[model samples]
Target: MRARLELFASIRRDARIEGLSIRGLAKRYQVGRDTVRQALSDPVPPARKTPVRSSPRLDPFKPAIDAMLVEDTTAPRKQRHTARRILARLIEEHDALELSYSTVRDYVRVRRAQIDVEAGRRVEVFVPQEHAPGAEAEVDFGEVWIVLDGVKTKCHMFIFRLSHSGKAIHRVYPTQAQEAFLEGHIEAFNEIGGVPVKHIRYDNLTSAVRTVVFGQGRNRVENDRWVLFRSFYGFDSFYCQPGIAGAHEKGGVEGEVGWFRRNRLTPMPVAKSLEELNDRIRYREAEDDQRRFDGRIRTIGHDFAAERPFLAPLPAEEFDPGLVLNPRVDRSSMITVRMVKYSVPARFIGRRVRVSLRASELVVFDGRAVAARHQRIVAKGGQSVQLDHYLEVLKTKPGALPGSTALARARASGSFTSAHEAFWAASRRVNGDAEGTRELIDVLLLHRSMDAADIQAGITAALRVGAVSADVVAVEARRHATTSAAEGGPRSDRHRGAHAQAKVQRVVSLTQRRLMDPAAVIAGLPSDSRPLPSVRAYDELLAKRAEHPAKTASKENIS
Candidate 1:
């Protein structure tokens, strides 16, 4: 075809250049006159050739290759033998066969329609029986590797599939905790538009099964809270046996598990945090549902749109993803939850406080406002949560004091007052023979149930007499024992006696003070001064002063 087209084109170009007639050129080129005329009139013409196809003799073994390709879809394309290899094998195996390598290649090329070159081979499309609207769903957990905050972590992938539409809802979480597992179901149900009426099949995850008893009967053991949550949500759980073979029983989710991992998580997604990773996974899963699977029929999302209404409506009350526990307040008036201490009101001391433990918060209430809120610490006993509960109690009752049990047990251990400075000052004075001061302190402490006025009065009496010794103050207390023991009590016999003794001591001390500072006494003289006085003359002056003031003055004048 190429030669014929080129020959005609060359002759027409020569005719136009040389002014040769079309018939003359046709003869010169040793061709038909009509062909020359057509060539001269048209710049180009289409070529024609006989179609050559593969001979059956060349690819007698094509049926065998096609069967192998169909059976092993997972095999690599290169691993599928070359056509030359197939031809040689045929010749060696059967001497009666005759086929060249090129012919075999041609046969393989012609039959390429049967080979799925892109996938190396064809896979049988999975077809599930049409299911009733609210019948069942398949549930499973897959694993995904992601980088959260620059650290690589393995996240659990939860997938739920509706039996009718093949609609899949999935999420990724940092942990496979029962809370996450159950919460995953709730979110999946919401995504699918409603909860399925029938059973949800699952593998033997510890979140669902506590133990996998053999033929005796599988235990559908789950966390108590999880069970309650499921009951509230209204669903039946079906657990598969704890082996690979059992996966066939719940093939829907099993297939979805792999399908989501491949289609949704393709290109190895990178996320800044586990939360971000989960968000990405959710978005892609939704997109996957909208995409056509096996390139046929309605998409998963489209089918789900129709099947959604048949599912049960979400209950009026949403599931509470919180754990409740009763934790007792410690002597510190604080309760420890999740390694953190939250304070309650001081009155709640020695009482149990109800704690509401959520994923991110630990909340404690005092029948009113939140008494304490903390970032939940997820540790057990001995690891405490410190709450600032009854701290204000300390402010109001400053003397309630603080000490370990042993400190309290040893009362005389001198950890008596929360006011350490006041205690220490009293202790020092008592040690310094100021027993009155110590007695005053003891009396003041006794006023723990008394008015401040009474205590202040007791302190005043002790200070007034300069008998501030703890013992002297004690003596005064005993003297006034007949009184109401309040600040203004009647004097008892003991009080009068102590008072008399105190007065006598004051007189003696005053007389003794004459020998020390007579000037003080002299300065306390009367306004009248008739005689010039010296220390020796003081006695005679005193004698003169004792007489009646007028008589003494007159007798002095007469003498």
Candidate 2:
């Protein structure tokens, strides 16, 4: 409008200076003659008048709509009548036959706003909270979808936020299981190097809350593990009210969860493995230290530094976050935990073994010793089988060795690499099927005493020389093992010395047997190397000696 006024003024000035007519001024300004005359008369453009619309068809129902709108202010927020409901009620009981839905909708929209303002409904107000450094933090879990190694994966993110510094830690896991919940705390505490203010606030998550007490003011029965955890860390737990009312209690972490996802995990990060994804998350957390929250005068790194000194010093030892279970090894020498099967030693079959289940690992214990450790499998019906666990049983039933799950997993994991495959093929050709499998089992047992790389190197070396026998593979494997031990320098510890001695014994025993075929050794020798001896030759020699004993004696001496 201002530009138009300026243009009209310029045009009038030009007309006065050059003596142009109104029609010429109208054409120059791209306006009508009347517009030019109005512009010349008034220096400012007229204001635009909005069209006045009326809901004539809805006039009879106006009182009812206003009544509903007025009553809605005092009614329950959720129970308030929506426009569609009001429309239905109007058509049903009010006989608003002539009213179109749009007419009623338009009136209701405008009328509700007016009623809300008149009734004093307005935007919510939040108090600016001042948190003491190392005094407060919030915890929450959020869902994240990602693509892992080309497969779509659903994961949960455990978010922790320090109230004072606004420093956050993000860790993702396969599930929001109890173990993961505890593990997230342990990891965050370790990363941050201290526990936040004495009180850590949380929603009434099932992992922490045993049962929520209704009609009580934030009073609830907490899980025993949760109690123990907070006690170990010397912190207090505060449960938020149930549902929407509780969201604001831990608002820092609630907002941080979405904030981190939008800024860092947007577009759904792609990673080959969960560990890789988590490493990336930690690196991002470190990078975020350089940034500051809104309204803060200092960077997150600077704020955290100021708060670090006030934070509760770390415990003398970290808390164990694993869940312990005693699962009996099944007939298959497997123990089921969290619906996933993991193989233990076959000897453990029918016996219960203590299993420690972490978020990413399963460790089996027999008596006080670690029986086996496996990467935890999250998928239902998934199995993590160690080939070494079944070697003893496989030796007696070699037929099962080829199709066993443990063997398949081993092959897939490169533990049973081409070296093992080549050795098995050669052994099968040289020895019968059962015997060859037994020999292979013996070689597999070597993994318990020697490094897998050393064993693989030995297999490659032996295969290079056309040696397929288990004895030959063992000899080569031990040669490498011994060389490795020597290069690793000597150890004085009793356990290490004992292990070294056992390794030496194994190498000596393996090489004590013949590595070459007897038939092959003799195949290249001459066949007719035996002399045509004779009884006649012996008689003639005796007669010559009798005839010329002295000559024979001299010839014998010379010879």
Candidate 3:
């Protein structure tokens, strides 16, 4: 094509500049006169026309093949027509003996695709979208595999991405539940410091969409909680069309999910827990601030810095994305939520308690105070019982402590160490089993007031001194607490370390604290400029009464 065009251009130039004849040009270029005439007429060569070849053997059956292909469109996929089936039908029904299976196979391949294209099944068109600053965002969940706690597990990654700046937030969760969905949005909004002004895009996830209403163009029956969340955040939700048709609607987040999973979570991330994995993912996302999107002049962080002002300011406080459940604490001191049991304090047994079930944790509330909190149980029928919750019960049933499940869990969690076991054994050997276990329980109760490290140090000290008493452990723990506070700024012990409600329950009282700064306290008190409190005036009155007593008695007698 290039050579022919070049020849034509040379011929046309020569004819115009040198005024050569068609025959002369042909003779000079060593070509025929007709070629020189063609070059002179057009500078660019004309495209060669392809002659249509006739499939005479299958030509008569073309209409039948077309009809069959169209019917195949609506037919069950397994029952759809194959080239061999079409040939058999042609021979059996139409008695078209002249047609070969090859003829039918070749025709079916081309015409089937043509039918799909004509019926709008194969071809699709998309419009180029331009997002305005923080006007739009997209959310989706992606599946990622990870080595969690030495077990290979599949996790869902929640992705929230800005359409314009390409700044995205990724959080990995155990499940793609409604709680995680709402929690992801809250985290993303808080991390980004704002919400998209216009709307956030999503696919038809059951978390947000309850029912997808067809034939109305994106109309959806959204989940009630999701609707409330949307209203609270003051953002509209734009649900994409259902199925593969909707994939491109939020292509930004879809691509972002794949990009993150492939690049950041590759080699299957290994972590002890979801929180640890999310920490790593968040750090990687922050590092992504330095990267530029395709065809962009600025980095993602630069664009986000400029776009942040355009976003709607975040709400004053975040919405609590947790489900509140009122479950009765059963005889086991357990509350059943979603078929899983979590232990509360034994005192609450046979009473209903309020529980806030969040994405990762559940909090059992005794009025306004947090009675107990535990990492949520993921498996059905699984139980999460805190040893602290049953300590009061264990105190009465001291023998139960030896074989209790709570004790086993505590030991497994490192909360109850070998030091605790050794101390308990020593106490039991010195005293009876029941008395020794009660003493151990009292020592464990010290954890509520003092830091764990201090309590452990206290246990170590008591064991060294062979005291084997709860009071001794308490005194030792206080000493460690005070020493640590003096050395550091309450990082390990003392006021901040102690569990308190109304005030910091320190190792010493407020009076002792004031004694440390008496001069400052004295300056804060009112100035005492008046003389010392006097009895001299009362004494003067008494003396006058004594002097006038006899005269007063005479006047009284006269009256």
Which candidate comes out best when scored by lDDT? 3
lDDT of 3 by residue, 346-449 (tens): 99989999898888889989899999999877789998877998889988999999888888889988899988998798778667799989989999999987
lDDT of 1 at 85: 65
True-structure Cα RMSD, model 3? 14.9
Give the TM-scores of the predictions, in the order they appear. Answer: 0.42, 0.74, 0.75
* lDDT per model vs. reference: 0.62, 0.82, 0.85
Tens digit of per-residue lDDT, candidate 2, span 1-559:
7787787688778777988889998888788888788777877877768899765677777889999999999999889998888988987998776776777777888889888888889845677788999999899999999998799999999988899999898898988888899999988898889997579898889999999989987788988988999889999988888888778877889889988999999999999888999999999998999997777788999999899888888899988788999998899999999898899998999999998898778889888899899987789999888999999888889999988888889988878888799778767766768988888899898888766876887777665555566676767766665565655634222234434443442222222112333332222334333454468757887777688778778888999
Backbone clashes in model 3, listed as residue pairs: none
Over 415-458, each residue of candidate 1 has an lDDT whose tens digit, in order, gives 23333233334334434424323333454444444444433444
- Candidate 3 Cα errors over 4 Å, as ranges: 1-61, 70-123, 489-559
Task: At residue 174, give the lDDT of candidate 1.
Answer: 55
